[model samples]
Target: MAKLPEGILGPVSGTIGSIVGAKWRGVYYIRSKGKKRKKTRSKKQLASQAKFKFLQEFLKPFRPYFIVGFQNEALYCSEWNSAFSANYKAVTGQSPDFAIDYTLVKLSSGLQPGLRDPNVRYAARNKVEMTWTFQDEPMVTYDDQITMVIYCAEMNKAQGSIGGVSRADGKFVFKLNPRIAGKELDIFIYVSSLNRKLISPTHYLGKLIYASTTKP
Candidate 1:
C-alpha cells in the first residue's frame, strides 16, 4: 500500500480514533487507537470488591485497632479468614498474597474474640468494675493491657479513659469524679498489647452510669 501523507488521518482525531503521525522504517505513518483490552470481572470479583468497600466504611473509625490485630496475626483460621479467602479468591482468582493491604488489615483487625460483653457493675465508691471471662479462646493476651473509658452523655463530654489494668485478670475498677457521680456515664473498654509497631484495636465492653455503693 502506498504511504499516506503525513498529518491527521481520516476519522482519527477524537476519543475513538486519533490518526496522529509516526515514523516507521524511514517513513511517516498515521495510526489510530488499538483495540481496547476488554476488561472483565466475574460476579464473585465484583462481590468481593463491593464487600471490601463496604467494610472500609464500616471500619473507618476502628482502623487503628484493626491494623494492630492484623499485625498480630490474630485472624488465622477464624471465620473471617475463611470468608475473606473465599471472597478474595472469587475477586482475584487466587489466594491472598497477604501483603498487608489496608482494607484487608482493617477487616481482619475488627474481628477478634466476640466475647460476650463484660458485665459492668457500680462499685463501692462511685467506681465502675467490669467482669468477664472467655469460654473458649482467651480474649486477654499476656502482653495485653485493658483500659476503661467513661463519658457522660447528657454533658456531651468524655470523663476520659482510665484504669490501665492487666489483661491477665480480665477485670478492672475505675473511679468516677464526684461532679459526675450521679450522672449516667457511657463506658468503653479496649485491649492493647505491648507491641509498639502495630496500631492498637479497641474492643468496647459496654456503657453504664456511675454511682456510689449501696453496700460494701
Candidate 2:
C-alpha cells in the first residue's frame, strides 16, 4: 500500500510493488524490500578496497593542508575527497599491489604560479629551512601564503605549516619534532591565496634524512 501525500503525481510513501518508499533526512527515496543476497567480493574488488584504505590512512595527516590546498577542486565534494580523487591514480600503484609512490604525490592544484629554484636544508638546532623564488605571473602576489608538509613514515608522523610566510619572504624555517629525528622524511610545499581561492601545485622537496644531533 502506497500513499501519495501530495496527490497521485507526488512522492509516494509505503510499499509499492517490490520497493519500499520512505523519507530520510528530508529526502524521499525508494529501495527494494527483498532480502539482499550475500556475495563474495572479487579479488579486484578486495584489492581496490585495500588500495582505498591504504590511501585514506596515508592522507589522514595531510587533512589540515588539504582544507585550503584542495578548496578550488572541492566545488562538489569535500576538500579531503577532492585531494584523494585528484591524486588517487598518481599516488597508488597498479592492480594487485597498490603501493604508494610518494615522489609522484601531489598535494595541491591550481593555476597559481609555483615556487622556482626551491630548496630545503637542515639548519642548526634541528631546524629545517626552505627557500624559493617566486615566478613573475599575473595575479601572483607577494602576500600569497606558503604551505609546507612533511611526512616521516618510519616514525608514522606528519608535520608542516599552512601559512604565516609569504612568497616575498622567499624562505621559512621550523624546528622538527625530536621523535622524527634521524628519519628520512618527504617534504612538499605550495602557495595559496590569502582567501584560499587559488593554490599552486605541490612541489616535492625530495626525501632527506633529519640527522639532527642537537637535543631539545
Candidate 3:
C-alpha cells in the first residue's frame, strides 16, 4: 500500500519491477515500454491489408453491415481472405494467392455482370428512367440484382438504390428534387446474383445533367 511518485498511488504486484501502476481519471492505468511498428509486412499481412482497403470501398454501398463496431480491419481482412481462398479453391481448383487481384476485382467490381448499354432520361415532373439489358454470364452464374449508385457531384456524397432492379421490366425509376437540376449527377450500375452469391464489376454510366425544373 506504499504510494509512488507522479500520482502513482498503488503497489505493483507483478514480477516486472520496472513497470508501475496508477489510478487516473477514475480508471486504473499501467505504464509499460512502447514498441515500434514494423516497416515490413509478411505476405499474409500484406494480403490482409489489400483486402481491407478494397472492402472499405467495395462495401461502401452497405457500410453499416460490413463496418460495424463488432468488426476490425485486420480481423475482417483475414476473414475475407480466408473465405475467398476457400471459394476460389472450390471454383477454379488453383491456389487463391495466384489470383488475389483478379478475385479482388471480381468481388468488388459492381458491373461485372456485363449488362448491355444503359439508357437514362428525364421523365416528367421529377423522375428519371434507367433501362439496361443483361448479357449472359460466360463462365459462371449471372447476377440479377441491380444497384444504382448516384454520385451527386455538387454535394460530394452518394445515394444508392438498393432494389434498383426490382421492377419486372428491367427498368428503374427514381424521383429527384428539381432544385438539383442543372447540377452534375454521376451514375454507376452494379448487379448481383439473385441469391447475392455473386456481385459484378461496376459500370460507369455517363454523367447526366438534371434538366427538369419546378419553375418551368
Candidate 4:
C-alpha cells in the first residue's frame, strides 16, 4: 500500500505511479521494494483498474450534451434581442430615425418571481424628443402635441406590461406660439413597479434621455 496525500485515504493507491506499479492482475506489477521482491497482487489493484475503465465510459457522452447547451443559449439570446427591439418600437411610436441608445443596469440583489420580491432586477430606458422652429410660421397645433405625448405614454405602458412588472416614464414638451406670452405646453408620462421600489437614481442604469433637442 502507498501512503496517500493529506485528507485522502483509501485502500486504493493515491498516486497514478503507485496504481501503475501495483501488481494483482497482469495490469500492473510491483518492480522491487528494498531487497525483497513483492510479487503478490493486491485486491486494491484490481479495483483501481475497474475505476479507470468506468471513468472512460462515463465521459464519452459529455461532448454532445455541451453542444446542445450552447445551441440553446444562442437561441435564447436571439429571441431576447427581437423582443427588446419590438418593445422599443411600440413605446416610441415612431421607428427610431437615428441609432437607438441603450443602457443596462444590473441589480445588486437577485429578484424573486413574485410581484414584491426583490431580486436581481435589470432595466433599460429610452427617450426621444425633437423641436424645430419654422422661420415662416408654426403649423403644429396643441392637440397634435397632446396626442403625440399620449400615444408615447400608451406605448411605453404597453411595453412595461409585457416586460414584467417594470416602470416606464416619458415627457413631451413643446413651445407652442412662443410669440404669445404663457402659451408653452408640456406633457409627462411616468410608470413604475407596483411592488418593488424604483431603482435608485445613483444606479448605473437609473435614467437616460436621448432626443433630437439640445442635450443638457
In model 1, which residue pairs have backbone atoms overlapping below 3 Å? Answer: 12-17, 12-18, 12-19, 45-91, 65-200, 65-201, 66-109, 187-207
Off by over 4 Å in 4: 1-40, 66-216
lDDT by residue (tens digit), candidate 2, 180-212: 755678899988888887889888888876555
Q: Please report the candidate that would top lDDT against the real structure.
A: 2
Candidate 1 vs. true structure, TM-score: 0.41
RMSD of each: 15.4, 4.5, 12.8, 24.8
How much is the lDDT of residue 7 in candidate 3? 48
Query: In order, how many clashes per candidate?
Result: 8, 0, 10, 8
User: What TM-score do all the candidates reach, one by one?
Assistant: 0.41, 0.78, 0.47, 0.14
- Give each model's whole-structure lDDT: 0.48, 0.81, 0.50, 0.25
Where does model 2 exceed 4 Å of error?
1-37, 92-97, 211-216
The pairs that clash in candidate 3 are 109-200, 109-201, 109-202, 110-200, 110-201, 110-202, 111-201, 111-202, 112-200, 112-201
Return the top candidate by TM-score. 2
- Comparing 1 with 2 on lDDT, the higher-scoring candidate is 2
Tens digits of per-residue lDDT, candidate 3, 185-213, equal 66666555565554555456767775555
Error of 1 at 125 (Å): 4.8
Winner by TM-score between candidate 4 and candidate 2: 2
Candidate 1 Cα deviation (angstroms), residue 28: 42
Alpha carbon deviation, residue 43, candidate 2 (Å): 1.2
When 3 and 4 are scored with TM-score, the better candidate is 3
Cα lDDT over the full model 3:
0.50
